[model samples]
Target chain A: MGKPKKLLNNPVDVVTELIDGLTAACGGDLRRLDGRNAVVRTEIADGKVALLIGGGSGHEPMFPGFVGPNLADGAPCGEVFAAPTPDLILDTLSAVDRGRGVLMVYGNYAGDNMNFDIAAELAEEVGIVTRTVRVWDDVAAAPLDRITDRRGIAGDFFVIKVAGGAAAELSDLDEVYRVAVKARDNTRSMGVALAAGSIPETGERTFELPEDEIEIGMGAHGEPGIARRKITDADAIAEEMTDRILADLPFSAGDEVALLVNNLGATTCMEMLIVARKVHHVLKARGIAVHRTDVGSFLTCQEMAGLSITLMKLDGELKRYLDMPARSFAYSRA
Target chain B: MGKPKKLLNNPVDVVTELIDGLTAACGGDLRRLDGRNAVVRTEIADGKVALLIGGGSGHEPMFPGFVGPNLADGAPCGEVFAAPTPDLILDTLSAVDRGRGVLMVYGNYAGDNMNFDIAAELAEEVGIVTRTVRVWDDVAAAPLDRITDRRGIAGDFFVIKVAGGAAAELSDLDEVYRVAVKARDNTRSMGVALAAGSIPETGERTFELPEDEIEIGMGAHGEPGIARRKITDADAIAEEMTDRILADLPFSAGDEVALLVNNLGATTCMEMLIVARKVHHVLKARGIAVHRTDVGSFLTCQEMAGLSITLMKLDGELKRYLDMPARSFAYSRA
Candidate 1:
């Protein structure tokens, strides 16, 4: 269709402009790093183990939107679908670092991993201790034997939620990192794409499919999915997605978990909720107990149409941290 | 495009299934009313002036998602884009009504107004007292002299927020009604539609427009708008929308207000944020102070592609209630 319509100006400046709008929406709770495409909390406590979250920009409310009270201490943003540069990440690292070290959490894309690692080395050179936990929760991206190869998806929210709480309460950065790793390890996600979203700069669709087909296990940024088939009802989709996630984690009977049915971008809340209903049904039949359920748009691929289901197997510590109060531009708990 | 893709089973059953899923996501904070397509808070306080909000089902998270602490006590749902029946509304009213009274707040659509009013009268016959506050916030829907004819849009959230807070805090039903009326009067909103969403049962688009054109002031259900024009950038659109809302409410330079940039489904967060930045810029230039700003999908028209800007001029009492903590399925403040 004639170049996917977008309400934007100077699309090359979308990342910066969106950051401006995001900070404005925050109402002074967050401020951008001067001359850098990054944001940090306005008031971080001294000696607090900082939690730093960052990623490419198109996924609104993921990295930048998550920076707030009881969430990430800061977020260094990259251009759309591109990882942040090492220098920008280092600058944000220094800004959010208190007397205690900072812990970096992000998706396990190669570009992000490399940039964040480089920044961590630079921070070490500056005597700022830091640890890293790359989230690889998308089971569709790789086999369980090579879990690190999987890409992070909506499960980033679960990892960030637990890590933010741990960073806030635990003085030691290592302890916070440990909890974040646990969160990442316990989470699993898989997505399907009914349609493609366009890029702001080019105004071109990211990918294309037939009118009545859907791609299962598709990555957020138009990566090829594991399977492409004709569109089906929500129950079958939900059952298949939940089955994959459950098998990956082997979430067995009586295992309480937090479930997330995240809208990829354009999927309506109605569709997500319908999927959520079937997912709950499937989980119930499998004898798994859902501790909590979240259904909304946490991470998105521009205006892409589809959704992903994420489940995080929770224990006592994870449940305590997950249930803590948080206030952010995108997510909040009370 | 090939009968607009939808993740649904038995579209006629969508309303009930979605409510089931919504209550599941609520984690025991909300439960459905027996034998009715409605939901109520599990533990509304004794002798409280209850708040009941409802409308059609397509605009999800509005009627159902907004039910929680410091929000509506219950919401009787209608089918997609259709008003709830009088019997269902009366049933929900009885379920949520405490001894004090019940306050009903909803959009000012013809069907909704008729149904809710009928229900209110029925409740009166049953020895229960109820008051109504119809939200007529769409400036494009009617002339200033005929304000009551305007259709409510995203401004429903602002009115509901104030009314919910007032109902919770005020012991007298008349005082709560006064506050809700004030909220409805102070709020104004306008929406522009880039594309249309489909009906679940028919799988047919609600309306159609040329690829390069947009309809300004279109209703959520594809009602005629004030103007149809070629696509434009965010700044021009935001300026025009903000100007209309400001002049309609006659918002003054010294007035303080809350700004909401709501997504009308399928529009990317980046676009919404860009619009928010320009709206803020426009307001700043006009010397209007924004007390708070919220940007997200509060109310949607099933996967419709567009956005709406809402302004609610605030007084001291309005500001206090607006800032109070609230938790719900779709919205939560901490």
Candidate 2:
């Protein structure tokens, strides 16, 4: 509620301390390039298109936890929701890049795009091939036609899964890029916030909303959204969110889709499943098939009280990759 | 706040729907015993000491998600916090039990223990060998001198992990029982609740508290905790919970331990890390070495606003088993 006194060195040191702690906790599974805020797992093998992703520190298991086998090769973590420097990205690419080039995948934020573009240029100059796929799955982030204007949310799960699986199979950079692009294009996400989040070092609320209301189109970093309205039942809220996402995606009857019911932050599995049930009904009413579903806090926004639904149209290739066996602390495929 | 709508067909139907959903989502990695609620993974090879573990339902990833290739042979899901019937447990044992016999491990709750005991008797009557190790980790649930009298919380993660690893390695039933007992003995846990959880069918809060206050030591079923206090700095609250856990366990200076900072329901990774940092600092100050650490929402209390910390005294065998590779939707060794 006031200046939150964190048990740390200082406000500026919070991010670095957290990163150091993460590095220590990961055992030998992860390695951070010297003098930079980027990290990569040791599992990256030879001659594969390295996938690099990151942006923000709090929504962990998202950018970093998703950096092991069949996922990304490296992640450049920034301050909470802040963009990492181009040098950090370059350093990360240098650490994991083999002869197989690299792909830079991240959210659709101007700061991230600007910095990653610079990193890509620098990487190219150094004789490493590079491509970028901007994730924009938030239907509420922008209008449907201008989907590129939307923000990336939980849909990053699908992006990481497809990109990682493609990389695992040693697909060429072009094919991996195409797969990543297709996954991104098929994903549609929207979120609702029930409460606010507080940045530990600053002890500041990322955004504000009335106690009795919720922001339906809330962004990950507490950005303002479509509108705030009275809180309704979980089913009603899930219905509203799913309807918006389904309409934006325009799935036909009997179309098979993979559902990702993700927690923006601290939403419970109980609540997530409630939303999942409603989503099941919503998709069923439209005759769209749900081939797979992931219900948990995969992509979170610090401790914000909210959730986002990401549905991707599942094709054979996508389903195959999504079903591929992989393991991480936050997610796994059978 | 009011009577929740009948999103479900009926209370008895919830478990079946969830079971069907679980099997469908498992991508053929999991299956339920015909006409029974018992679940087993397809990769469970014969001749192992069939490590079977389970408890109440609602702890989705806990009792079922943990059953897989390198884990338990089967899990019997109950209703809410209620224990599954002895017949249900017998069904699971008969489905997965090999000539190597079976070892049952579960929380120390009265209902669970009673049913498991009854199931053991039935197994013996049929000339089948069975044993069980009860997990008691919640320090607030009992006195320090009677640690085994405490309730089990998220500490099940460490216990199941070690037990599963031994079982996969074809450890004898006695060895499996020993490992389970060691984990349950060394493990200590404590919880703090920021809010209450709602029962899905009735849409009612299992417990209630003032807006500005939280209940410490609350159980998964929304029971009253040790005390209620106003929320404050995250570090202070983390220290409060950690202090109680450490004191109850009485870990000496230079004692090596593995820590599990668990999210009860909706706590975010950022907050979980904040709690972990504080706990780490506290232990580090005492010269205690945290050989391994895991922080996440492994065991949840629906959408309850809280978290629990589980500390296990580490040794060579415990560390090896804890470090063993695992693949589940909610956890992984790597």
Candidate 3:
């Protein structure tokens, strides 16, 4: 087992303790719903549309770190790598929703889709307005013809970011939902895993791959990838990952793009920056103008030593939302 | 080896490529000095005191990620875990100086002090005003009588953050230097290491420890800590770390503090938050009000799986400086 030792009590208690610690450490910016697996911003605007996003734990900052001002108003946290139950999502939506309604967004995982769908219906039964945009931006998960079937990966950051900003500024839920759908349409991503991250409870690697090799286009939760092969140079890996993601989005010459080279977990910024240079080389060679680039752990899979490259092709509308100032424990812009 | 595998090509080129990639990926916010091993904000306010911080590499977001308008005005980077050459620091000061002066700040390592001290003299000879503050806040490395000999760790974040914000708003170099000194004097930190992390160039673990144990008070670069023992509960570890740091500073009741639970590198946010809660509890039970709390990877030591806890006892003046808005590649507050 190559899995590194973890700092955890009982692995089963990881999520609950993580939430309690986060709420405590958050100063006064966040709070948890009583006896519920939901974390919400301390203050919700009176008439602003609420943005709620969640799926599983382990992907820190994805669900909880992002719940603050100028970001998601609330996060319905689930157990590690597992979807939140419908009942929990319902509780989150009801608590966060103001008169302006709510928007549910998260990765397009099967369990998440089923759970959130039911929760949305349950919300409406209580006369609360709610809509959703399940992000499907992982190009490797499916062919172009089945784009929507692709699993959501790190690109969930861009979609949720846009939705959060829009939800805060837009008066109506429809406008916020529209921006989320559009952001999802404009984003594409590809990932490569160097090692399988362990699940805290079992201390087990979710999957195994040969040493001196990496699996390109691997899903965050150890989902299948395109193939596993000998570890190549960073430039070659960057080129291949960039080529696949670029073509899927077909981000052509003259396109302006915001690129995010997200650390899957334990990959060093030293290595990520090396990869970032290769990404810039390929995109620049094609005459694409890179707009904003984020190179860090925007989303992670525990301590997986891998990275995901995500590109959000910017249009006038997407760029506007992307640039909006927001403050969260995870993502902050001044 | 517990260190996870890294992603890179020709590990010797990690630093150069990291600088290049960061320059390209920054999208206009940052740039590198021509013919110099330094990174600086693209625009420096004329006549404002320049704040420059740096040290050995591998600690991402420390030396370079903090270079921006609201943070350090510039960073002079060195080889991984090695101090920048005096010539490099001289070049950085010359390039970033906006006429007021430059403050050279970083950890109080032997190599760093020697290098920056020489650089300060060089800057003065070149007609550039310069001051220096070497953070010595690690409590485990020395007794209270020998505080000046203590190694700097995550406490560098609090010192630099206050200095940067003060430099931007303070009227002169002397004022900035005074505030930086005050902030440095008020900061303390303690860390624990669960596993060793590797250096890309050698791919060698920095140190060795038992798999089921942790070394309390370990330095960021695997420097010797207080003791190594069987793994303990998060709250217990937190209690020990907090008690030592608090007593070192004698941070008493009725004091307001800013807390930082920083991942040394690969520790999960889930675990960090759990630790954060314990840190908060320890401080709160003692009647200390945490004015602000930061729980994430501020400064890192590659892919090491561990964390450090830092506290800055904030006075009214320090709090005002810390609250000033600043934006950098890694840190942002709106």
Q: Write the per-residue lDDT of candidate 2 for residues A24-127, one digit (tens) a residue.
A: 55657677667466778777777878999888777766787777777788899888778888988888988888788898889999999999999999999999
Candidates 2 and 3 compared: the better one by TM-score is 3
Question: What ranking emerges by lDDT with the best candidate at the front?
Answer: 1, 3, 2
Off by over 4 Å in 1: none
**Candidate that scores best on DockQ:** 1
Off by over 4 Å in 3: none
Alpha carbon lDDT at A287, candidate 1:
94
DockQ of each: 0.86, 0.27, 0.74
Which candidate has the highest lDDT of all? 1
lDDT of all the models against the reference? 0.92, 0.78, 0.88
Candidate with the larger lDDT of 1 and 2: 1
Worst 10 residues of 2 chain A by lDDT: A1-10
lDDT of 1 by residue, A301-334 (tens): 9989999999999999999999999999999888
Interface RMSD, prediction 3: 1.3
TM-score of each: 0.99, 0.84, 0.98
lDDT of 1 by residue, B279-303 (tens): 9999999999999999998989988
Q: List the residue pairs that clash in candidate 2.
A: A254-A287, A264-A301, A266-B266
Cα displacement (Å) at residue B127, model 3 = 2.0
